[model samples]
Target: MYVTTSGRIHNFGAGPATLPLQVVEECQNALPNLNESGFGLMEISHRSETFQEIIDSAMGRLRRILTIPDEYTVLFLQGGASLQFYMSALNLLRPGDHVDFLVTGAWSQKAMKEANRIGDASPRWDDSENGFKSIPKNGEYSIRNDAMYVHYTSNNTLFGTQYHHLPDSDGKPRVLDASSDIAGVPIDVSAHDLIYAGAQKNLGPSGVTIVILSPWAMKRVGDDLPTMLDYSVHSSKGSLFNTPNTFGIFVLDRVLNWVEENGGLEGSVARNIAKSNLLYEELDRSSFWKPHAKKDSRSVMNVTWRLPNEKLEEKFLQEATIAGLGGLKGHRSVGGIRASLYNGCSIKSVEALVIFMRNFEQANH
Candidate 1:
């Protein structure tokens, strides 16, 4: 059996990213028989009281950490944010109902496409002209007051851009896809009508998605929606409408507990800012490296940059991998180096990466 030893490499993958070592260890200890239920976590039934406790604990901790408002219902459901792209449209919009989208990067573009398939989705504004390096100015988008909802991705993982401030929806319900940077930073949950995130990034493992929605948003859900695709159905049943991702939820619960113990959303945001600043400062100090995103729009969670050329980037990736720094390669759609500094990434790891970057630049230049 494979075991995580003290020699674990610093992970920088975007999703399925690194998790707190303490959480992993706790899960390891409980895998055999969770809560002394005589059955392993994977072997237990989802309908059991033990599993209910686990899910409830996960929800409570998430609420405490994020300060989720009392009016919003949190549902831990199957399918990643991709499913939510369509599910949100199905429940909240109908044929000919217009939904405004702010396309910042690949993920938001996909979200718009999905919404378009179900409703009259149109881009309020797109930053494609700038290669998505910066977010659109506040007044740039022409938002329609008649639109049912406005959808946006909080952080663009591919382009390394993030919206520092949310758009003014002008009383329109806002749907936010916060998959990449959910728990890594603080957000006003009440500011959004619907917020969805895939668990793999900052929350936990893959296979589960977290959806937090207000009662106002739930009331707008379309009638005769598919049983599983209906947000109201899952919310009504307390996310126990069907067999959920038991193991994933279990890990997520432990991860949230880790977040609370360390501090909360505010604490996590401070840590993320410090880590990203370290890397950004180092990148700015070196001409050999070029950060992809603009200064104000850069993502605290995913710091993407490029070397002088593709050959240099390839060499850097190879050397970094051998030096125990892995998953530095960026997404294939946008080829470059991306060091994702998720919540689980420690400041020491960022410092080590910055040191490696400086040495690499010096040796090459």
Candidate 2:
């Protein structure tokens, strides 16, 4: 039952988010033999022409979908978004150069900790103080103009906070982790110096991180950096530095193509708005439940909520599993309920989950 989509199950896993039904069907055909090449997409050679086409198509569609300026180049590389945190820090920052990070939740906390260990860094506005419920609007922290980069996790998957309004840091290069929110909606990429997203949630799958960096940021990698850790080498080699994730790139291409056919970013954004709005509205209307993230900065991708108590949260998870909404439990660091509604999560899925929420509320209350 879990294997099939039509049995009224809705997957709410934050990473490894749901892929479109059409993509699954395409996978069925492409799995056996990709475009009659007699090799499945997973089995295709990464250096082969077929896989190159897949990579090119995916990168091109990513630019189109993200409205990435021609100034930035899209690179598909191995490693999740966490790898990107380290790489972004290492490539953009010199040993003693100052950097700014906005600590919002678990992902950024990891990013900050990792960046702190590597180079000079500072944080601007962080609201982990209020239990990660809100994004800092303005704060006393002074940003250095010559800062390497200002980093922020646009959407906090763990704590359900989002920066609906981005920070205004004059003349500073900015880096954003749009990992869980990529392609679910449109963004102003021009505002940031660089952007990185893991394909798992809204893009495609694990093992691939997509980056669009400014030409300036790309050149900052000095020869002293390790060859494997350098973006310049990866970009010069067309993300073919070492072996690329051929299968992940292939699926991402298909997913982005699906986004194009289904009305591109605007269509996905509208659908995502509807899906997340439904789930959040359910949480708002139910007396037995409450949203964890603040109202002004609620995430449209990951919605975290909780019952009155931990025991009730456990009970909700058990009942929700029985009801076929998989991976609805929150991250262990902030345990409760987290309904991840990414690009491919259908409105029908949200509707069924809302029904489950109503049932859970009734039973628990």
Candidate 3:
């Protein structure tokens, strides 16, 4: 086996982001023989008591951290947040029923497209012409009172926009795709009828998606649905309808434990705010950089900005890589630099990035 290095680079990737070093070290120690089970974690059977305990621990910790109400059921499933786009429509909507979507960015637009295949999904309001720079204000959309549910993305990873406050659904059921900023942000769990997140950004890793649903939302799941696509089936079976991602759940368990120990959602949010503020402050202070999203709708988790020109942005990323920074490249849809400060990204890393930014600006200017 190759020996690992002592110091780690500051990672700013959008997804499959950095994980807490403590959680990674704990997983490493347990991988060889989990809980003294006499077998490696990957070798253990999912039905074994060892695996059962792991899943149960993960679920319990997530509930404690999020303060999820007892009436809501949490399921750890395979597909990422992308699957929930259509699954939400299939479960709660029929051919005639309609679902309203707030199209703020690329992910929500994809969700609405998927929902359209299932039912009469329509965009209540779209801000694409403005380059998805900000979220629509309250009462800006013409919501149909008879719609089945309103779908929105809590954070748009591609465009770097976030909703600081959730929309007033007008008593209609709210379906949120919170894949990018779920555990990193504090939320009112009771306010949403259904919420789903892919466990790659802030939670743990990919391959596991957490779906939390209220009792009323579960009741609306369509009958005769395929076993795999049915939320009610997964909830009834306790997210063990099929073989689950045992390793993913194990890592998630450790991550949630870390979150709770560090002060739960509130603590995560505080850390993220500090990191984002540090970077944004430097960006705003310099004329060499230009932020993508509006100040009011900027994402605390992902800060996207452009340099004076593409050549400078390329040079900055190349030099930043040599200086032990990684994943500073922006998304393909929008060309720029993006720094994703997930829960695991430390303040030290953000400070280093800001220092590098200032140096680069000074040298170039």
Q: 212 in model 1: Cα distance from truth in Å?
A: 0.5
Candidate 3, residues 129-221: lDDT per residue as tens digits? 999999888888878989889999999898899999979787788999999999898898999999999999999989999999999898998
Can you list the residue pairs that collide in candidate 3? none
By TM-score, is 2 or 3 better? Answer: 3
lDDT of 1: 0.90
Compared with the true structure, model 1 gives a TM-score of 0.97
How many backbone clashes are present in model 2? 0
Which tens-of-lDDT digit does each residue in 140-229 have in candidate 1? 877887899999899998889998997877678899999999989778898999999999989899999999998888888888988999
Question: Which window of 10 residues has the lowest lDDT sum in candidate 1?
Answer: 1-10
Instruction: Indicate the worst ten consecutive residues by lDDT in candidate 3.
Output: 1-10
lDDT of 2: 0.83
List the candidates' TM-scores in order.
0.97, 0.95, 0.98
lDDT of 2 by residue, 288-361 (tens): 88788879889898899878999999888888777777889898877889989898888888888898788777
RMSD of each: 1.9, 1.7, 2.0
